[model samples]
Target: MYINTVSHYLPSEVIGNEYFTNINNLSHEWIVERTGISERRKASAEENTSTMAIKAVESLLESIPYSKNEIDLIIGATYTPYDTIVTLAHAVQHQLQIPDIPVVSISSACSSLLNAIEIVEGYFALGKASKALVVVSDHNTAYYNEMDTVSGHLWGDGASALLISKERQTDSDMHIKKIITGGAATSGKAIEAVVLRPNDRGVIMPFGRDVFQNACVYMPKVSQQVLHACGLSIDDLDYLIPHQANHRISLNVINTLGIPVEKLISNIQYLGNTGCAGCAIALSENKEKFKKGENIVITVFGGGYSYGAMLITI
Candidate 1:
């Protein structure tokens, strides 16, 4: 599968670290030192996961001359959705006015984008679809609690869209070389380490030490698996894009892999942790920086003790 275009959308409202510092009674420098996030965008009342997804898809469609009818598959990835019954993929299809296409929603937390890519790759390999729209939209602000400083302050709202096709359509297209995903429930207690409850006071709670430790181990493991599957080593990677869950996690993964820090592509300092949209948003934002024939390795770990990696050629 080839990526024809990638587009991302961020809301107008920017929430700085000072907002969290004042609300949580923590020092601004402390938050930055721990998470390396300075600011993040929060969706306005009018924007939800679906709306932000549509905006991204529209932006991607506008850039490419492909007709909406050409898109036969629509995949939506998000853990934070306003409505559970009406999937974000269906909402995007409704907005785009596409008929009878398969609209699938994936909820694999931070690894959602990589999972979606694997699904689209299967569809294309099976001759089931020619054009696919993969969108990841998350609005964590809707469920965030001011009192919960652990995971609450790390989240932001945004969406990213990718247009994937069976064949390369442009000279700038990126090819998906390999995608590998796996999950390990270390223990029963690990299952509840990261969760967003269903109650009215739904707030994301993360066991910091468990998450950090697991991320440090699983991210590099999965990345090496994908790299080996593609017959490439860490030194062969032109860029390393890991899920922007935490700056510490990113640094740990880089150190574990022994990859140069300059080759790592990170925008978490400005965008915060956007759940499923983080890696895709980073990829879209840095699309122009990649040179032809260069290789990129993207690794991600999220809730459910899930982790995955993908190798792409630019």
Candidate 2:
């Protein structure tokens, strides 16, 4: 179970913190200090979750055009789907012209893609599916509250897709060294960390304190466990990518763990928070940073109040 190819699509609209000052009492400095967000990209009217999924899958297909028929499963991991009845998997399958493959949608928030990785790991191990496509996308601004300054400045619109494939003879061309991939919930935690109620027009309600605590405790611990499972240590990883929820959270985790700042792929400064697509987009956005044979650790705490971590040898 290895990631053979990857692609991502970001929205066209860019909104800076200044736009919020007029609507709320928050200033650019306050937002950056609290959540470490300067700007976030919002989806335009032309873009939907389906359209964004197609954009990423199109790029993914180009790199493996002849292998389309080999794919048997398509997983669309998104918290923001355009339609309830029609799964988002159909959008990628239809655009890519692969009608026979099973298409399904899953929503686990930021950890959805990592959970997808675990799903494919079993699919390959159990001889259920040879090849799978995992795509994570969301359009939060359409439903996000403008006044909820903490969360509003943190989320962005983006979609990322990855092709998981198996090697014919265990060649070095592709590799996936799965270290720990999933973790149980921390005790006494709420079922939902963040929620929005449209009926009352409430802000993107989130227990930021709880989210921050979860990331700090679970993320690094899982990262270490994954590395140990891989017969490696934290210092051995060349790149570490976490859910770009906030710069402060990322920095706090790595710094507290004493992992070098250069070894981390901190993208919260630019991408804001992309929910399930955040870590995937970071990997896609920084693929070049990974040298062949370099180890990487990806950890995420998603909206399910669920968390997952993985160690892969690139």
Candidates in order: C-alpha RMSD to true structure:
1.3, 2.2
lDDT of 1 by residue, 71-137 (tens): 9999999999977889999998998899998889988878899999888988888898999999999
lDDT of 1: 0.88
Cα lDDT computed for each candidate against the true fold: 0.88, 0.77
TM-scores for the candidates: 0.97, 0.93
Q: Where does candidate 2 stray beyond 4 Å?
A: 168-174, 183-188, 196-203
Candidate 1 segments whose C-alpha is farther than 4 A from its true place: none
Per-residue CA lDDT of candidate 2, range 90-183, in tens? 7788777777766778777678888877777777788888888988887777667777766766777888888887653233334667745554
- Relative to the true structure, candidate 2 reaches a TM of 0.93
Q: Least lDDT summed over 10 consecutive residues: which range in candidate 2?
A: 166-175
